[model samples]
Target chain A: MIRNLQVAPDHYLLELRLPAEFPCPEPGQFMMVRLRGRDEPFLSRPFSVHNFRMHRGSVSLEILYRVVGKGTLLFSRQSKGTILGILGPLGRPFRISSICPTVVLLSGGIGVAPLAYLAHRCRGRNAGGKRTSIIVYAGARNAQSIVGIKHFEAVDLRICTDDGSRGFHGPVTALFERDLCSYDPEKTMIYACGPPAMIGSLARILEATSFSCQVSMEERMACGVGACLGCVTAVKDNGGRIRYERVCREGPVFDIRDLAGLKTDPC
Target chain B: MNASGTFGFGEEFAPFVDLNELGALVVKGLSWEPRQGNPPPRIIETVGGMLNAIGLENPGARAFIEEKLPFLRQYDVAVIANIFGETLDEYPRVAEALSRAGGIKAIEVNISCPNVKKGGIAFGADPDIAAEVTRQVKTATDMPVIVKLTPNVADITDVARSVEAAGADAVSLINTLTGMAIDVESRTPQIQNVTGGLSGPAIRPVALRMVWQTVKRVSIPVIGVGGIMRAEDALEFLIAGAKAVQIGTANFVNPQITLEVIAGIEGYLIRHRMDDIRDLIGSLIEPDSLEHPHEP
Candidate 1:
C-alpha cells in the first residue's frame, strides 16, 4: 500500500508499506513496479530503492523516480490506495567494506536514489566504530532538477547544477575533481550512479586517479529476473575481452575499471 | 512445459513456483561456446507485446553441465536442453557434448533465434538446411530431438515437414516473430540491435494459425508455444492439434502461470466429464469432412 507521495520539481517519491515478510533490500538494489489492472504500460518499470524503514510488523520502502515517459507520468498521478505489482529486491548491490574508510557517492539527476540508500547504510556501519566518512556529490540540470536531496542530510553534501543555480556552478565531475585532493586516495572508494554521459566522463577521470570506483547502470528491461536477458551491459573481463553481462542478473553494479571501453561507447 | 530462454534454468523462479509441477523445464539457449549476447537496450514494451534481442547469451555447454544440470536434476520434471550453434558443425558438437554429460532428457534444437547474427534463423529458413541440422543432431544423440521452427519463414510447414522427414521425434512452433519498435522523440530505434523478435499476447493469433497449419503437415507431435498466459490459451492450442504447449513470455509476468495452467486444464477436463486430456487434441469442428486435411 502507498503510504505517502511527495512531488519534487521533475520527479516524485513514492513510499509503500509492505508486509513484514518483505525482504530487506540492500543499497543499489531495485524493484520492478507496475500498476494493477493495466496492460497498456505492459512491462514493469525498474526503480532503485531510495529509502526504507522497518516497523514492528511492517516495512515501508521508498522509490525516487523522474517522469520521463508514459509509465512514470501515470505513476505520478496514482492515489494512496493504488495497488502496485512489484518484483524485486533484484540485481546485485553495492558493497561497503571497512578496507575503504572514506566513502564518496557521486550521482547525476535521479541517480541519487541508490546512493542515498548507500549513505544510510554507511552511517549504520560507522556507528559500530568503523570510523567511516561519507561524502555525497550530487548534480542535476538546474536547482529545480535536483530531487532526493533530503535523503543525504546525514552525510556531507555538495550540489552541482549545469546552469549555476545551485551549490556548485559546474558538472558534478568538476566539483569532484577539485575536492579529490582532500580525501586520502588510498582510503577512498567512490560509488556512482547516473546518466551514461556522466558515467562516461567519470570513468575517464578515474583512470588517472588512484581511488577505486563502482558504478550502477540502467537499461530497458523486460523480466526483472535473468529469463528475458534483455538488460545487458558490455564489460571487459580480466583477460581484457569484452563480454555482455545481464544488468538484471550479473549486475546493475560493476567495478568502473571493468567497464573501461564500453563506458564511452555504451549503447 | 517452459520454453527455452523464457525460464532461466528453473532455479531463478523456484521461490515463486514449484519446479516439479511442470511438464518439463527447457533451459535458456546453450551453445558450443559461451556467447556474450547483444548490447544494452535489448528489450522494449509494445502494445500487448514485448520485443527482445538477447542474442542467446549462455555459459558454454560444458559449464552448463557442471553448474546447471545438477540443480535441475533435483526436480521430478523432465529437463530438455535447448541447444543452438554458430555453424552447422557446431550443432552436432553441442548435442554430442550434452549427450555425454548424461542428465538431459531431450534435445530441443533452437534453429530459430532471430537475435543472433548467424546460423540460427539461417538454418531454419531453408528446408534442406533445417533437415540436415535435424539429421545431424539425431545422429549425435539418442535423446528425442525436437526441432523448434521460426515463424519468419515463407512456409513454416515446409520447414516442419523437412525436420520430420529427417527423423525429428517432435517439433515446436512458432518462435518469436521478427519486429521492431522506435522512440520517435529521440528519433532512434528502441532496441540497439535495430530489430528483435516480438512475443506476448499480440502474437498469439499468428502463433495459433501457424500451429494449426504445421500440425496438419507434420506427422510428429507439435509442441505449441508463443504467448500462452492462461489455461484457456493452452486449451486453444491443444484443440488446434498441438499435443502439448510450452509457456513462454507469460512466465515473466506471473511465475505461477504454468502451474495454474496445468490445474486449469485438469479442471477443464473434470468439468467437461472427460477422462483424458488428449481427447481435446485436434478437436476443432468442421462441416466439410472429418479426415485430416493435409494427408495425401
Candidate 2:
C-alpha cells in the first residue's frame, strides 16, 4: 500500500511500503498508481521512482507527482494518510556501474523524478577521490515547476524556464548544449526523463554532437506491467524493422542509441 | 475480478453501475510508477469489437497504494488487485504490497498483457513462467491468486495447467491477443500504441474456446472474460465451464451489463426453477457424456 502524502498544494508525494529484502529499484525505474475518488477520470497513472529507503522489514518507494488530469487532480485533493492502490518497480531501471564517474541528469518539467533518484544513486556511489560531479539541467514552463533540487547538496542544479521568469531563459538544451561541448562525452553518461517531445528534441541535438545519452521514454500505458503493450515506443532494431517497444516491459528506461529510427538523426 | 488492459480495472465502470453489488471489483494494471499511457487516438471502433493501444497508463504500484485504493474503499466491493510485471520477480513484489492493503480481497495476476516492449511474452506465452509467476505470488501472500491467461499463446491449456499446478487458487481467461488498426489514408497505425489488444464480439469465439480448453485441463474454476456483452453471453461462458464471468468490452457500451447479467442469471434460475446458480454452471454436454463431470 502507498501512503498519499501531500507535498505542496496541487502537488503530492506518494509513498509505498515495499516488502523488505526485495530488489532495489534502479535509478530510472518507475511505478504505476491509481488515484482514489470517484471523480478521477484516468484509471491508472505512472511515475518515475522518486527514491527509496530500506528498513528492517520493508522497503518503501517515494514518488512525487503533480495533478494534471482526473488522476492527479483527485490525488492532489487527497489529505495526508490517505492510502492508495499501487503497482510497481514495473519498468526497467537505468543501468549504472561504478566506473561511470561524471554523470549528467537532465529533465523537462517533472521529468526530474527519476533524474533526482539518479543523482541520489550517483552520489551514494561516489567513492574516495572519484568526485562524481552531478550536473542537473531542468527545464520547465516556469520557475514554479522546478522540483526536488533545493535539498540536493552534491549536485549542481541549473534551471531553465521557457518564460524566463527565473534562472536562464530559453531552454534546458541551451545549458545542456553548452555542457555537451565542454564535457567529456566518454566519461559522462547522460540520464534523462520527462515528456517524449522534450527528450526527442534534445535527442536530436545530442545526436548531432555525438553525445551518448540514455533516455527514459514516456508512453500512456494501460498495464505498466508490459502485457498491455499500451505503452509502446517505436524502435528500429539492428536489422531496422521498426517494431513496437513496450515501455512498461522493456523500459521506461532505454539506451538512446538503441531506439534507432524512433529517434531523429544518426541517433 | 476483471483483467487489466481490457478494462481499466473497476474504476470507469463504477460510475454507471453499483460496484459493490458485484462480487469483486478488479482495478487496472499497476506498474512501479505513474504512466501517461499511449499517444493520441488510443481507441478505435470496429464492427463488433474495439481495438485500443492505450498503453497501461497507470500511476505505478506505489501511487495506486497511496492514492487509488482509498477511493476504491468507498465502495463496498471486494477490491481485486490486478498486477502486471516483466518477469517472475515483479509478481511477488506487487502481491506482497497488495497483501498489506486494507480492503483488497484477492490479487489477479495479469498473465496476458501484450503492451510492454520486452519481458511480457516471456511470462504470458510461456507456461513455466506463467506458473512460476503464480507460484511466486502464492508464496508471497495469503490472498487468493488468479492467473489471467492471454489468448495469443500457442497452448492456452498448457499455461492453465501450469498455473493450477503452481498453486493458483483460480485462473481467468481470455486476455486479448495483440492487435492493431491502421489508418490507411494516413499510412500509420490508428492507435497510438501502434498495436492494441482486440476485445468484444470479435474475440468471443476465441475466448469460449480457450475457456473450454482451460476448464477441461484444470479443476480450478475459470472466470471467462473477453467479449461478454449480455447475460446470455455470460450464460454462454457459464455453460462452457466457467464458474463466473468478467464483463470487459461491454462495460464501455453498457456499464450496467454486469448487474444485468447477475439479474439475468437470477431470472434464468427462477424461470427454470433451478434452486441455485451453480446448477446452471458447467451445462456443456457432448452427448457421449450425459453425467455431470463435477458432481460429487
- Give the best candidate by TM-score: 1
lDDT of 2 by residue, B92-168 (tens): 88889878977789888887777666555568888888888888889999999988888898889999999899999
State the lDDT at A265 in candidate 1.
Answer: 43
Alpha-carbon runs more than 4 Å astray in model 1: A3-6, A127-130, A262-267, B287-296
iRMS values in order, in angstroms? Answer: 1.2, 8.9
lDDT of 2 by residue, A1-267 (tens): 457765545566777776576568878887766654322232457788888888777788888887765456766666655666555566778877556577888887777777888788788566334768888888787777676564356788888888998788867776777767667766777888766666666777776665568888776655465444455676667786555566777877887766744433221
lDDT of 1 by residue, A1-267 (tens): 575455567588898878788899999899988876566676688899999899888789999998888788888888788888888899999988677778999999989999998988887465334677788999998888888878776688999998999899888888998888897777888999998878888888787887889899988777788778888788888898888877888788988888844446431
TM-score of 2: 0.54
Error of 2 at A115 (Å): 0.8
Measured by DockQ, the strongest candidate is 1
Instruction: Go through the candidates in order and give each one's DockQ.
Output: 0.69, 0.04
lDDT of 1 by residue, B140-195 (tens): 99999999999999999999999999999999998999999899989999998999
Q: What's each prediction's clash count?
A: 0, 74
User: Each model's TM-score, in the order given?
Assistant: 0.94, 0.54
Q: After superposition, how far is residue B286 of candidate 2 from its true place, in Å?
A: 25
Which pairs of residues clash in candidate 1, taking residues 3 or more apart in a chain or in different chains?
none
